[model samples]
Each structure stands twice: as C-alpha cells, then as structure tokens.
Target: MNWQRYYKFFNYLNIAEADYFATPEKATQAISTYNRALRMLKNNKDQTEAIKLIQTIADDYPMFPEPSHIYGIHLAEQGEYKEALEYLKRVSLLDITDEMANMLQEQFVVIERELKAERSSARTQTQKTKETPQNKKASLGSVLQKAPKHHNKESLSKSEINAINKKLGNEDPSDLSEEIARENRVSDRRFLISVFVVAVLVISIFYFVIRPAVVNRLDGGQTVNQLQWLENEITDRAKDDPEINKLLNDYLSEFSDESDK
Candidate 1:
C-alpha cells in the first residue's frame, strides 16, 4: 500500500477519498480507526487509552493533522503549553479547516503570552533577590564609613554596641551574594538547555518529517498551498526570532522558483 497517498490526503489536501486515494477501502479503514480514537477520547474513563491510540495513529500516519490537533488541544488543557504549541504548529502544515486554523492561531498567541509572562516574572524575582543582599551590604558599609574612627570604647552605649554585634553575627552578606550568584548561574544553564532542546526538536521535525513530505509533493507536481502557508508562518514568526529567518527565507525563495515553473 502506498502510504504517501494517505499522507497527502490527510496532510496536503482534504479531498474526497474516491478522488484522493488509490485504495478507498484502506482509506475507509484508517478513517474508522481515527473515529474510534475520537470516541475513546470523548469517554472520560478511556482518556489514557485514547491518547495512546491517537499517538499511534500519528506515528503510523506521519503529518496526519486531526490527531495532532486533538493531541495539541489535550496538551494545552493539561497546561503543557510548550509541547502543545509544537503539536499545533505541526497541524498548521496541513490543509486543516478554517476553524482548526483559527484555534491554532489562538493557541499560539496564548502560549507565547504565557511563556513571556513566566520569563518576565522570573527575571523580576531574581533581580529583586540579587539586589536585596547588595542593598544590605551597602547600608552596612555606609554606617561604618560614618562612624567616628577614634571614639572611646566606654563612650558607646551598651544598646549601640549590642546592635553592632547583632548585625555582625547575622549571616555573612558576601556568602549570601555568592549563593545567589551561583543560583543565577544554575538557572541560566537550565534555561539554555531548555532552549537547546526546543531548537533541536524544531530542526528535527523540519528536516525529518516535513522535509520528506514536501519533497514528495514537489515530485508529484502538486499545488504549493501548504508550502505557502509554511512561508507565511515562518515570516510571522521571524518577526520575533530573526535567527531562523534567513535559512527559511532562502528555502522559500527556492520553493517560489519551483512553484513559478
């Protein structure tokens, strides 16, 4: 069985099975399986099984939009926004309905906003924590600088001497500062790792999954609507991430030349 036909039907275009598939019986069977998965998803008792079934379908039929869409929604509802966004972005490569497209766009906006807010809050808290020790050190230094250098020991009140000793006995400000800096470094490392993982995932999906489908479509001399959608998505995303713009633009230029022919 030529699975590419099924891939094109579910990914590139939403055409009738009779017109799109060489074997209508196989297509019908796939659709039946998809429906069964959907029904399982609707049943609260079968949710875990439903997700496994959907994931199996997705793996078997790479780039099939419906399973990705369902899984994306499920992930979002579970508060796993980053993974949800990735799955939804995959769905955008397919010929999904306008409703699905709209939902994808909304999810993108929400996830981006959530991530931005989280980063902002973390930075603010870190900054405040880092400043606190510095401010205390500065205040202590100012007090020492203004103190009389030659004051007679007996001239100091007992309360004043006790206060000075109490301040000195507290945890060392330098030690606290060092700990905060260490924590910041660890946080920075973790953030960089997260970014690297996400980047690798995006690159892998583009190279291993989407790239093959695109080459297959081009070889078949099919419409370039899906490619156009991808170009537009990249264009919009490039506004926020300039790093990937040049690579994607270069590829799109090649696609444009081929489509023109």
Candidate 2:
C-alpha cells in the first residue's frame, strides 16, 4: 500500500467527519490547553506551569503540531536553543500545513544562527585566554632586559642587585619566577575550562539537532510498517460495527487497486 495516500485519506476523513472519529475531541482539548498556556506566557506570569502544560500536550498529542511549534518558539525566545531545536524538529515529523512548514523553516534558521554565534564566541574567548599568559611572559622578559649591564661580569654588585629587587616590589628573583609560573598555570586552567564548555555545546547541538534528522530519514520503512499496524488495529476494533467495517473495506479495496496500477 501507498502509506502516504493512506495517511492522507484518514487525515481528511478525520477532519471532514469530526464526530465520527475520536480525534476531534482530542484536538479540541489540545487547542484549549495550548491557548491557556499561551495566555500565561502573554501575561508575563510565572511560566513554570505553562511550560509543563504545553510540553504535556505536545507529548500526548503527536498528531497535532501546533503545541510543539509553540513550545519550540518559547524555548528559542528564552535562549534555550538546543531544546528549541529539538521540539521544532519533532514538529517536522507531524502533519503540518504549508504555513506551518514555512514558519518551521524560519525557526530552524534562527536556531542555527544562534548556535553558530555561540560557537564563535566560545572560540574567541579561548583564544584570548591562551594569549594572556604569553603576553604576561613577554612583559616579564622586557622588565628583566632593563637590568643594569655590568662590564664583562656575569654577576651584579650588591647595590645593583638591591636596586633591581626594589624595582620588583622587593621580591626575590626566584619568587618572581614562581609568581609568573603560577599566573601561567591559572591561565592554562581557564583555557582548558573554556575548551571543555565549547566541546559540550558542540556535542549537544549534534545530538539534539543533527542526529534526529538523520534517524528520521533512515526510518522510512519503519514508519510505513507502523502505519500499517495502526490500520490493522482499527480494522480489528471495527469488526462488530458494520458501517465502519464497510467503510474501511471500501477504502482499502480502492487503495489496493490504485497501488496495483
């Protein structure tokens, strides 16, 4: 059977004869819940409950795309880009209208731009951190180069040594070396921390954003089998209802003939 045609036919039937199937009531409830959540967001109220409600509706009613779309938008507005991308990706898997598809594409672009900006910022920070220690080392070298030059002598006189130590805040030369080493260590630690944070963001973007799209593309046959199973279940449930059984048989026969041709 042509799974796309079967899905579209059922979808049209559900919309045209809302009272005949259970989907109309569910859709109504989903819309009501979504509207309530939207009001909470617009009023600037505490959004904890509102977020929870929308998330629940999105999970429970996968056939409806609006809840997921709105949830993704909200997350994106809050700067939760990774989660927003994930929710929006879910919306793509559902039956969406042309307008919804356009909106979804815009959202994907926004999320991608944000992720790229974050990655750029992270790299800049890491570069600055790594440069700091080198700059400090250069400054220290310049200070040492200004030391008084003794003619053909490897060692400085006592007075000259005292002057040099006083210029260095009375710190011993060995202490100065240790202080520079400590500063370098601190800078290294900061650089490592920045690199770790950037790594985590890259991994999250790949897992939540890229991985789902690839998996969905590879699962076409699995999706068709799922639809077929749903059709069988509906047929089994309608065995005692002559009207529903007749309608199912008629559509099935019609589609089977089309598939043959």
Candidate 3:
C-alpha cells in the first residue's frame, strides 16, 4: 500500500536521477526508493515489479501502516472491499493521525456493510432452497438420471414418493399387471419342465424294472411261483418308488377284470 502518490522533487528528474532513489536500505529511504522505482516502472510500462517491491517493504515494516493503508485504498478502488478493509483496518490501528484514522474508519464502515449484505443474500438463497419443492424434485431427478438402466424406470421415476409407500408395504396396482403376468409365465414354464423330468424318471423306472418282469412272465420264462416271487418283491419295494402305489392300484384293477372275464 504505497500511500505516497506524488513526489515533487522526483517529478522533474530524468531516468538516471530516478534510479538513484529506487534502491535504498532504510524505511525513509525505501519510501523515496519506492516512489522513484514506481515512476521508472510506469515509464517502462511495467508495474508488476513495482507492486512486488512495495509489498516487500510493507511486509518488512508491519508497524509502518503507510504501505498497508495505501495498498488498502488501492484495493478499495479496484472493488476489493474485503481485502481493502483488512489493510485499512491495520492503518487505523497503527497510524495515530486523526485524518488517516478517520479516513480508514469511514472506509471500514462501508466495507463492513457490503460484507453483511453479501452474507444476508447468501443465507436467503440457502433458505429458499430448503423451502422450495421444485429444487427438491430437480435434485431427485438428477439422482434418477444417474441410476443404472437395468433398474426399473418407473420405480426410479417415482422413487421419492415410493420410499414412503415402500415402508407401509404398499404396491402400485399399475405395475402389477405387467410384472405379475411376466412372473406367472415364468412360473408356468418351470412347472412344465418339472413335470417333464418326473415323466422321464417314471418311464426309466418302468422300462428297467416293471417291463423285465412283465416280459419274463409273458414268455413263460417264470413259473407261477417265480411270478408270485417277483410280484412279492415289487410289493415289498413299492414304498421306495413314487409311482409304485398308483401302478400297483392299476395292476390290481386289471387282474381283477381278467379274472372276471
């Protein structure tokens, strides 16, 4: 914050005389040095090094509020009110002069008001976001958009509302028609497959066990005693076969019919 803007003595000096003031060691000499360097910097159309050099002096002499105060005023002019307030506040604390103190205090009041207005505006925005339903819907829509494609589209679309419905174990009737019908079709196919497997098992059993016995009996390879022996064996093992009970019942009915004939 180089507060000292114009130097009457250095104004008329050439570039060579200005260089003599630019490099100085002490605080008083540094101020003169800064003013000369600043002019030289402006003449050369380069202010970057000038600002850095001024900043270094301000940092080196924290008690000297001149640099900070000037920098604060410069920042304030550039619309950096908060940063300006910081440097101006430093000047208020350190500089005991009534004019400088009063000036910094005035700037402080203005900057403080601006900061408070900014904070209030931010709080109002936050409160409106909390109260608005549209914002909430927008946020939920964003979440649904990110969801995987395999997930039910209808479920994601109504996710916010469905969350409450899910807790009560309530289902949407509109969804049941398609979903239930599809489930029923799958279940019917599974049932038919199970019946086919059972039929294969039954045929295998009949071919391996019942057919051999029946063939032997028909060929007269087994006498009446041997046929009876086979029948007794089947009867004894009937409980082990799922189809045996029904088969025995049918066989008994046929035998009775033949005897009647």
Candidate 4:
C-alpha cells in the first residue's frame, strides 16, 4: 500500500542488479505497480515521493509514454510550463494511445500560447522603455561620457558650448559668449600690467644702482692717469732750469708734506 516505499525498494534493487530490469515486461510491470501505489497516497510525503518517482521513471525509460505524460503534467502544475511542453511534445511523438496523445497535445498548445503572450508583453514593455525621453537622454549622456580621448580643443570648446546652451535652455548663447570674452580681456589686461611693472623695476635698478657705480669707477681711473702725466711733464721742465727746478722741487716737497700730513 505504501507505493513510495515499494518504488524505492525496487529502484535500489534495479541499481544493484541491472539484470533485474533487463526485460521490457519487467520494467513495465514495476512502473504500473508504482503508479497504483502512488494513487493511494494522501499525505505530503506521498506528493514529494510522487515527483521523484515520476522523474526517475521518465529518465530511465525516455521512450515510455505513460511516465513522460505524467511527469509533464507534474512539471506544468509546478509552473514549469516550458519544460512540461517539451516532455508532453515528446510523449505525443512516441506513438502512445490516441486519447493520451490528444490530451498531451492540448496541454502543449495551452503552454505554448501562454509563453507567446509572456514574450509579447515583455517586448512591448522593452519598446516603451526605449521610446521614453528620459532613457533617450540618459543614452545620449552615456555616449558623450564614452567619447574617445583623441578629441581636439575645438571639439572640446564646441561640446562646452552645447552644454552651456542646454543648461541655459531658451537663453541666448551670444550673451554668454560675450561675457566669457569680457572676462578673458580682463585677464589679459591684468597680465600685461604685471609685465610692465616688472620691466619698470628692472630699469630703475640699472639706472640708479648699477649705472652710477660704473660711471664713478671710470671717472676715478681717468683722473689718476691725468695726474701722473702732469707730474712727468713738471719733472722734465725742472731738469732744464736749476732755479726753476729748485722752485718746483720746493713746491712739490711742500705739497707732498701737506699730503702726508
């Protein structure tokens, strides 16, 4: 009466001795007895056992119609319509009884229709998502973000201009362009003023500090040379006249004594 236990015992025996189920008649008889016991079960354990037993039979005898038909219906009950459809379609092609084949064919058609509807609904939702302006805008942003690094300065400027235009919405681009131009002009003027101030400082240092020191050194050298030439001329004239020489010597000695003091 415990069909699940009965199926499990036979399943284990068959595994231990593959020759036990070597004959088609023996396999068919075991499957039929298992199905009868499964119908008697009325508990949760029975439901679980039924699923396992049916799946095992389907796998063991892939060409068997009864097991495949039941397994397909079980899968359909579990909301696995696509998988159920495949098994049921296989059963229909296995040359089973006309009544059983017709039943499986009906189930297959219903599952196929449901799958088609689900696919259609999904496609419609996808199309709507693609057509949305928000999605389109996001896609545009993605493309711009993915732009290559080879872009030139002019392209960058144009992109900036376009971004500004978008941000301003209905405002004039010319006004913004003019404003930027004015700011640039101010920056240029500040730069020029800085250069001019530095140049003036350099010129002032050269004239007042460097130039004065150089001129003083040149004048000192010229004066020393002229004094030496005058002293030489006086010595020559003194040698020719004794009185003049004495007078000149006395004056020179006095000058030297004064200079020493």
Which candidate's TM-score is highest?
4
Residue 237, candidate 4: how far off, in angstroms?
6.9
- lDDT string for model 3 (1-261, tens) is 232342122232233432332343454566664675557544744555656665675666666555566566657656677887877776677634676666676667777887888889999999998888887898999999996787435655576666667678786676468888999999999999999999999999999999998998877854777868877877877889858867777777999899899
Off-target runs (Cα >4 Å) in candidate 2 are 1-31, 42-48, 142-261
Could you give candidate 1's per-residue lDDT for residues 66-154 as a string of tens digits?
A: 87777776677677778878888888987767877876687688778877887899999999999999999999999999988875458
Q: Cα RMSD to native, each candidate?
A: 51.2, 53.4, 18.8, 12.7
Misplaced by over 4 Å in model 3 are 1-33, 37-49, 79-82, 92-179, 214-261
- In model 1, which runs have C-alpha deviations exceeding 4 angstroms? 1-30, 132-261
Better of 1 and 3 by lDDT: 1
Least accurate stretch of 10 residues (summed lDDT) in model 2? Answer: 1-10
lDDT score, candidate 3: 0.66
Rate residue 250 of model 2 by lDDT: 88
What global local distance difference test value does model 4 have? 0.69
What is the TM-score ranking, best to worst? 4, 2, 1, 3
Per residue, candidate 2 scores C-alpha lDDT tens digits across 13-86 of 22433222136777666666766776665564757898788788877865557667777777787788999898
TM-scores, each model vs. reference: 0.41, 0.42, 0.40, 0.43
